[model samples]
Target: MAKWDNMLSMLWMLRSGRKLTAAQIADSLEISVRTVYRYIDALCASGVPVVAESGHDGGIRILESFKETPLFFNSVELKALVDAFKFARGACYPYTEELESALKKVENGLHEEQRHDLSHQTSGMDVISPSRPPSVVPLLRELEQSAKEGRTVRIAYRKANVEQADEREVDPYGLAFDRNEWYAVAFCHQSQTLRTFRVDRISRLEPTEARFEKPERFSTSAYFRNQSEREREADGPLAVIRIEGEPDTLNALCGHWHLRHYLTERTDREARFLIDVPTMNKYLPMYLMTFGTAIRIREPLELKRRIQEMAYGIAKHYENDPD
Candidate 1:
């Protein structure tokens, strides 16, 4: 609440690899640019390596060594900060504790009013923890342990689509949960390839002493965005499809595959969209099948043909297998 604390906080934030202009800082702190300039002066005088650059892209930069430097935020500020980390934790189970610890420090620093405000704000935006069963928790715990230890483990898994099951030996790297499905990202010892294993579908897990190492450049975000149970893609470039349909029809396919939610949606009787698709592009074909009468594909003749073929095949199957 004090000017000195706010200045320290602002400097720490700027050091967190973010650049804030005087106007932006003033607006955020409900202060004037004149005060921000004073704070910047103090930081410079205090041996804080604050660099301000004048360009369209540059504003300020605190060199890398700034992490070892000092910054302060009271407990209330810290708990308030946990909001983003907790919001993002669904994809980064591996980083939630580090996020929580950072939040704890801020929480410990907050005064009573600040703490009350934070508690109210956090409660206002409640996120119910996913309904992970107790039995599964232990398995998840084991998977997490093995992942961190780079330990090989055997998992008995079932593929939902195939309605079949098998056992796999894998070198676990990390665990992630999306919606209701939990997945383990790991290297399959038998397949000698990286693959994702669904947690619930895992019938069994056996931790082994066989240890391994994660690849030096493994990125969980990249793996999550790229890997999912989807229609097999025919490789090349992202399949581009021109789709014309009502907004409702198109919205369902917005986030699918290489399909980007383009800014090109337009409506007459129908909305027109330019969608990028994965190589296989199942959504495009199946979608065309779903709205056989309502939607049309205006480009990519191969997709149009596939839609036609699918309809014909479905018609024939229904007629032949009238049971």
Candidate 2:
């Protein structure tokens, strides 16, 4: 038998709660007495709780408490682990291959009936991503490693609306995923400020010898949230967006990601949000138009006028077209 197999067999023998001598174990396994002692030492190092007492009436035996405890996961635990793996894979987790290998070993330790139960439970449920996820595992792995090691990296990043990628050296603090996109929160040496870069927009990344000390209690999520809040506040002066509509329509409008942050009040037929005037005039008009007659803008006559102008423009454009 292979070394591992022999050691496992010896463990099972000790688990029988019998006080068998080293010579007796070797004789049963067709190995030398010294080999039995070596296997016992290996099992102890692996946390098997094997007890080898010397002298008469003293023999190898597993601890009573250790023998009573279950070594393999139950059905519920197995199902949760497999389902979590599915979600992680859907999110493009960088360590998915290693996670899968670890899960397989866990499953292999289960009984046949437990495995069957897990298969049946997981087959009926799955996570459905809203869109096809981007393939960014390599980028995620590299950034994660650099952040963990406190190392700086140079990246060729293409920002939105820019035609060419620019090279920048940044100290990657951490990575975050929001709204189906991956972002690296880092400190840019060129800009001398902390910034967020879209991982998918990075055209090239290379490690540098530069290193940095991460701040104590630094939280990537909190920093990202604060940045978003500051941006919203910087748009312009706050203005009330009052709308009267069907209950469901109002609910949907109030629940919008951008609008929800500013939602002030809601009723069966009305929803009120406190957002910036520039944002309302520049972006909200077209989106509100989608609701058509189902909703009515109750305040900020400027928004209603903007929506009318957009509708008239659409009407005239289509009227003049031949097709």
lDDT of every model, 2 decimals: 0.69, 0.84
Q: Which runs of model 2 end up more than 4 angstroms from their true locations?
A: 1-77, 127-135, 161-163, 233-257, 260-286, 292-323
Q: Give the TM-score of candidate 2.
A: 0.59
Q: Candidate 1 — worst ten consecutive residues by lDDT sum? A: 255-264
If scored against the real structure, what TM-score would every candidate get? 0.53, 0.59
Q: Give the TM-score comparing model 1 with the true structure, all chains together.
A: 0.53
Please give me the total number of clashing residue pairs in predicted model 1.
Answer: 13
Top TM-score: which candidate number? Answer: 2
lDDT of 2 by residue, 1-323 (tens): 86667887887788788989999999989999999988887666556788878987898889887844324455677889999999888777789999999899888766567778999988987877655335478889999999999999999999999989999999999998876778999999999999999888998899999999888778888886576567663567888888999999988887675767678898898988888887777779988999999999998888988988999999988997886
C-alpha lDDT of candidate 1 relative to the true structure: 0.69
Model 1 RMSD, rounded to 1 decimal = 10.4
Q: How accurate is candidate 2 locally (lDDT)?
A: 0.84
Candidate 1 residues lying further than 4 Å off, grouped into runs, are 1-6, 9-80, 85-102, 128-130, 135-138, 156-168, 178-180, 190-193, 220-239, 242-251, 257-283, 288-323
